[model samples]
Target chain A: MGITGLFLISFLMVHCFLNSLIFINDGGETFNLGAEFMAKNWVIRAMEIVLFGGLLWHIIQAAVLTRENKKARPVAYAASNPSANSKWYSRSMGLLGTILLIFLIIHLRHFWVVSRFTDEITSGKETLFNEMKEVFSQLWVVILYCLAMVSLGYHLLHGFKSAFQTLGWNHVKYNSMIEKIGVIISIVLPVLFAAMPIAIYMGLIK
Target chain B: MSGNMNLTLKVWRQKNKNAEGKLVNYQVKDISPDMSFLEMIDVLNEQLIVKGDEPIAFDHDCREGICGMCSLYINGRPHGPKDRITTCQLHMRSFEDGQTITIEPWRAASFPIVKDLVVDRSAFDRIIASGGYVSVNTGNAQDANSLPIGKEDADLSFAAAACIGCGACVAACKNASAMLFVSAKVSQLALLPQGQPERYLRVHNMVAKMDEEGFGNCTNTGACEAECPKGISLSNIARLNRDFFVAGIASDN
Candidate 1:
């Protein structure tokens, strides 16, 4: 679970970096060039398969873990003070991951399915930024993206350091540093992903 | 500390595993502040015995903190209202006059109610039996200092060894995770030379046994540590994960 999670963390970094190219504000020239490279590149395409596999494996692991968690406590406590134990984000990883799954489904349907299964993306001739504009044109789509980003933020906040901790990468001297880095990465990545759709909807990015 | 306090008790009473359980209320008059929490329970039991009623059943062994037998969830905190103290060590002085204290057993499917406050903790025992010890030869024990372990490692291992296999960590967990308990055992042995031969297998087999027994994954809540009578730190859990992760990669060959 931690391995796949860290894999996605790295994937998100590359994903967000690519998405940020749209902010170049050069009318989608650079964004489409990058998108074309991603679409046509064999290595990136192969990695895409691995990414999907990692995603599915992670989802399955989560479902099993959550089921086992529920089974562990057949009867709920009459009273609990969970906030006193850990941060809400840390405790709510399963819920956040589920939400992120929903976001991923919507996101893939909007972009990936079209890009791969069919030539509907028209990426070679038409810039993919237009795809973004069309998708974000709907207020609800933009809203959903923003909402999913919130879940992603919380998920990453717990997940980043948890991955390292689970992998035993923790050091007494460096554990705090890793946690601080995890916090910064969690917030920054999701905010950037969310900003793209909001900016497009508001005409901040054209 | 000489004064006595009047208080109402809401204690869970269940006939057995299949019976429906509920909070049965009782009143105790003049509970001495000087008495330990279990002593007060003893007083209540004596009252019930004189009245020819079934006395409430709870788990306990040594009145001191060492034994992990006492597993009461009092006022929503395991081992009563005090921090780092078992139910046997909690004092009546922690309560106020006319206070209503609610007591319940550990809530977990793995720990079904046996009769009242006592739940079956054999699940923990099974996990321990799966692999909680070193594979030692049947002979005279080696000299303690022969292993040449560092003082830092020795102290940490001792602290982890302090775990008495109490199910409080499971009861205190939101997910009912036994990570702290299992990790404590894992760390205790894994730190020693005796555990070197089966270190990887111990974590692998023990964690599998834990899951097979239907315990939840560790979410790193730190609740187990806070409620632990022995003050078992979450660092042990981190070490367990590290060992388990390494084992997984290593065993791939």
Candidate 2:
């Protein structure tokens, strides 16, 4: 679960970096070229396959683990409060992940699957960049993406450092530093990724 | 530092795990805020013993908060109202006069009740026995610099190792999961050079044992962090998932 989640985070960084080019004022041509390259590239397609597989594996594993956890404690205590021991995000990973998964489905349906199999939306569009902008033009789509990215950020905050610890990279001196890094990666990447679509739709960047 | 106060204590008293338990109310007067919560409890127990009562029995040792032996659910919070301090170190000053405090044991199936407020946390020991240590047998001690570990890795390992193995994570968990504890132990050793040899086997075995012990899976509530005396991070559980996944794949290969 950690490996898959971390891999997804790495993908987010790259995706965000690529998307950031949209803001470079090259008249959408550069963004269109990048999109076209990604669309045609075998390596990118292979990576997407891995990313999808990782997402599926991470979700499935979390579901199974959650089911097992419920079975482990069949009875609820009369007075039970969990805030005394753990972080809110640590305990809510499954819920947040589920939300993110729903967002992923919506995302793929509109962008990925739409771009690949359907020609209805792209009939009059000259470039993939135009289709991308059209998709983001809808306020609802942008809002949904923003919400999902926020959830993703929350999941990553807990997940980033967790992946390191599981691989046994925990050391007292470096643990705090690694945790801070995790926070930055989780928070910064997702926000940056979400910003591009909003910025493009809002005309902050042409 | 010395101020007298009146307080109402509602403590759970049970003869054994099988025996029924309920909150028994007792009024404590003249409590000094300077006294630790446990010391106040000691005063109450002394009064009970003098009155020929059995007195409240709770598990406590090394009141310094490192042993993870002191477990309490005070007024709906684990280890009392203090943040990042164990129940032993919690002082009375945190509470106001005429306040009502509730005390209970660490509630979990794995930790069966040996007596009032004292559950047999031997299940934790069993989990550790399953694979919490390194199999490397370096006779005596090796030089610290022998293994040129990065400062970052070393620091992370130490942080993971800070887990005191208290069942607070389990109790604080809505699902009663022990992932934080198990992961911290697994990650602390797994990250170190000495722990590499048995990393796969260790995680696989320990996680399997944790499952067998009836500990819940992590639901990611972050309550454990709020209640933890050591403030062990939930990221450790995430690390556990990664290691387990790797181990699962490796074993399959």
lDDT of 1 by residue, B102-166 (tens): 99999988888999999999998898899997768624547765668889889989999999887
Estimate, for each residue in A1-206, the C-alpha lDDT of model 1 and write its tens digit: 88999998899999999999999998988988898899889999899999989999998988887887888888876756666556888888888988888888899999887777776666355457888889999999999999999999989888988887677777789988988998899889989999999999999986
Cα deviation at A136, candidate 1, in Å, is 2.4
- Candidate No. with top lDDT: 1
Give the CA lDDT, 0 to 100, for residue B97 in model 1. 89
lDDT minimum window of 10 residues, candidate 1 chain A: A119-128
Candidate 2 differs from the real structure by a C-alpha RMSD in angstroms, to one decimal, of 5.4
**TM-score computed on alpha carbons, candidate 2:** 0.74
DockQ of 2: 0.29
For model 1, the superposed segments whose C-alpha errors exceed 4 Å read: A117-120, A123-125, B1-4, B135-142, B245-253
lDDT of 2 by residue, B140-228 (tens): 54665676898877988999889888788787777787888898899899788889888888889999999899887654556776677
